[model samples]
Target: MPHSIKRIFTWIFWIFVLWAIFTSPNRAADLVLTIWEIILNGFNAIAVFFDRLLGG
Candidate 1:
């Protein structure tokens, strides 16, 4: 990707982040929590899979 395009995307991302922070902070926080939960659940699933594979 071109440098200009990268900068544009970075600016857009920051703008969106600031917008989320300034507007409906509670909802933004909930979104973060939901994403975190999804990541943790994925890790747990991977651990379970490995455990079963290893005959643990």
Candidate 2:
């Protein structure tokens, strides 16, 4: 049940993100930065998770 809820929310989240990207007037560098932001956010989440596990 919890897994399904997570999946639904994730889908909604990504839909909104994609909408934002398409609606924005952005250059190539802006697109690159958006990609970088996504990658960085993923890395930051991983780092935070590991940091909590290791520190505790």
Candidate 3:
């Protein structure tokens, strides 16, 4: 993307995040937890795949 568009998006993202944090902290926390769970699940799946591939 263009630099100007990237900056605009970055600003918008932070603004939304700040708005979420201040307006609905509980929901924000839940969102973060959900994202973390997704990341961990992805890693676990990758590890399992590698283990199976290596016959371990």
Q: How many Å off is the CA of 12 in candidate 2? A: 30
Model 2: CA > 4 A from native:
1-26
At residue 10, what lDDT does model 1 achieve?
Answer: 100
Q: What tens digits encode model 2's per-residue C-alpha lDDT throughout 1-56?
A: 69999999999998977877777747645877999999999999999999999994
Q: What is the TM-score of each candidate against the true structure?
A: 0.92, 0.47, 0.96
**Model 3 scores what on Cα lDDT?**
1.00
Prediction 1 TM-score vs. true: 0.92
Candidate 2: count of backbone clashes, pairs at least 3 residues apart or interchain: 0
Stretches of candidate 1 exceeding 4 Å from the true structure: none
- lDDT of all predictions: 0.96, 0.86, 1.00
The 10-residue segment of model 1 with minimum total lDDT is 21-30
Question: Model 2 Cα displacement at 6 (Å)?
Answer: 35
Task: Identify the runs in model 3 with alpha carbons over 4 angstroms from their true place.
Answer: none
Model 3, span 1-56: residue lDDT tens: 99999999999999999999999999999999999999999999999999999999
TM-score of 2: 0.47
